[model samples]
Structures are given as structure tokens and as C-alpha cells.
Target: MADPKPALVLHLATGGEPLLFALTTEESGKLAGKLAQLVKTGAVESVTTKDDSVVAVNFAHVAAAYIDDLARKSTVFGMHA
Candidate 1:
């Protein structure tokens, strides 16, 4: 079976709910880099999620962004196994 894809998680500064975009590890890395650049410029950018939905993100409003690689099995205490 193929491995599960990772998700790109974005937390906004407005402090509501976070945005999630499913993608592969490589794609997540690429997007993360792009977000970093956008954040530096405080630009508004559009990102395509796994569902093929386009989301417009304002970099100035983004607090944090990361990849959620769910394939990594975790222990009871949330430590990677």
C-alpha cells in the first residue's frame, strides 16, 4: 500500500481555526518554502489544497505553518515510535 500523504497546516494570527491542506512530503516542503518567502513580503497568495480548492492566504495574517506527517506512528504519550 502507498504511504499516507502529509498535510500542510497553517495557523492564522486571527486565532480562529487553522487551515489544512493535504499534500505529499515534497509538496509540503515546497509550499513551506514558498510561504516563508511570502511571509517575508507580507503578500497575499493562493494555494491549492488536496481537494482542488483554491484558498487565498494573507501572509501577514499567518502565524505559523507546518507539515503534519501522519504516517509517523506515535506512542501513547505522543512520542514517535
Candidate 2:
């Protein structure tokens, strides 16, 4: 069996829950670059998730963003550890 894919995690400066998106490493890298550019220019961008959900993100509110590539332990509720 193949291993599960990693997720792209975004932490907002507004002090709420971090946003998680299902994305490949390559996709995550591209998105990270885009986010950085948006931050530099103080712009808002719309991102499409793996699930086909469109999310509008304001880079100014993003505190941190990274690809979560760690091996995750399974939980009872099927959430990532």
C-alpha cells in the first residue's frame, strides 16, 4: 500500500485554528511562494483546495505556513496527529 500524502498547514495571525489543506509537496511549495508574494504586496488571493473548495486568503493575516510531512499517528476520529 502507498503512504498517505502530506498536508499544507497555514497558521493565521488572528489567533484561531490553523487551516489545513490536502496538497502534494510540489503544490505546497507553489502555494507557499504565492503566499509569500501576496504578503510582500499586501494582497488577497483565492486558493483552490484538493477538495475543490475555494478559499480566499489575505496574506497579511497569515502568521506561518508550511508543509506537514511528518508521519502521522491515526486517531479514533481519523484526524492527523
Candidate 3:
């Protein structure tokens, strides 16, 4: 029998536009469960897959702060690269 296609996992953080961070995925469901557990600790946007790669982004208060800071930093740096 043919094998099932791998799924890309993604975790969306709260506060901003819900950015999906690339996470790892496998045939087993352990990673998905783990992601759920983490999301329970804070406001999680969603869980998704793309191109057969798991993606997970932490959406805690610290995550929001970091994203904001990162945006500011990028703006300051400009689109050089």
C-alpha cells in the first residue's frame, strides 16, 4: 500500500496577524499533541500543515513581545537583504 503523505505543521501565535512558524512533523501524532499542549498555555491561533512540513510557533506573551521587537528592528534595518 502507498504511504500517506507527510503533513506540514504550523503554530499561530496570538496578538498579531497570527504568523505560522515552521515546525517538524512525523507519521506519528506525538508532535501534534505536544503542540496542542503548548497552545493551551496561551492564546494559540491555529495548527496547520504545508508542503509536508510541521510548523509550530509559540504564542505566549514573550512571543508577542519578541515579534513586535523584531518588526521594529527590521524596520530600522530596512529591506537591504
Candidate 4:
């Protein structure tokens, strides 16, 4: 079998549940860089949730973003893009 893909879990500063996203290791890293760029350039208006929803998260609202290596074993549970 092929290697499993990586996944990421984002924790927002808001008083709600955390958000989970399935992405390759490269993608996750790229997102981190992109977030940093957004923070610096203020180029992003909103972010798209992995669950097909749009959320408006400014730099201040981003509490943290983590790469969930353990959860990488599971891939979208039969869902698609």
C-alpha cells in the first residue's frame, strides 16, 4: 500500500470546537507559510473550512494550527474534495 497522507487540526481562538482538515504534509506546511504571509500582508479576507464551509478568521482569531500525525492514518472517512 501507499503511504498515508498527513492531516492537520486547527484550533481557533473563538469559543467553539476545533476544526480538522486532511492534507498532505507538504500542503500543511504550505498552509502554515501562507498563514504567516496572510498575517504579514493582510491579503486574505477569509478561509475555507475543510467541511465545505467558509469561515472568516483574521490573524488575531488564529489561536494555533497543529499537524496531527496520528490522525493521518484516516483519510476523510470516504469523503472527497
TM-score of each: 0.66, 0.61, 0.29, 0.45
Give the per-residue lDDT of model 3 (tens digit) for 2-77.
4333332222333334343333334234444454445457654444443454434444632321111221223332
Q: Could you give me the TM-score of model 2 versus the true structure? A: 0.61
- Residue range 2-52, candidate 2, lDDT tens digits: 465666677788778878878656566677656666766757877666676
Give the lowest summed-lDDT range of ten residues in model 1.
72-81
Which pairs clash in model 2?
none
The segments of candidate 3 whose C-alpha lies over 4 angstroms from its true place after superposition are 11-28, 42-56, 61-81
lDDT per residue as tens, model 4, 1-81: 556544555556664666665565656566665665554554444544445455554555656555555433453433222
* Per-candidate alpha-carbon RMSD to the true structure: 4.1, 5.0, 12.2, 7.3
- Candidates by lDDT, descending order: 1, 2, 4, 3
Angstrom error at residue 63, model 2: 1.1
Candidate 2, residue 38: how far the Cα is off, in Å = 2.4
Question: How would you order the candidates by TM-score, starting with the best?
Answer: 1, 2, 4, 3
Better of 2 and 4 by TM-score: 2
lDDT of 4 at 76: 43
| Higher-scoring candidate on TM-score, 2 or 3 | 2
Kindly report which residue stretches of model 2 are placed more than 4 angstroms away from their true locations once superposed.
Answer: 1-4, 24-26, 70-81
Worst ten-residue run, lDDT, model 4? 72-81
Q: What are the runs in model 4 whose C-alpha is more than 4 Å off?
A: 32-57, 72-81
TM-score preference between candidates 3 and 4, better one? 4
Candidates' lDDT values, in order? Answer: 0.71, 0.67, 0.36, 0.53
For model 3 the local lDDT of residue 35 reads 45
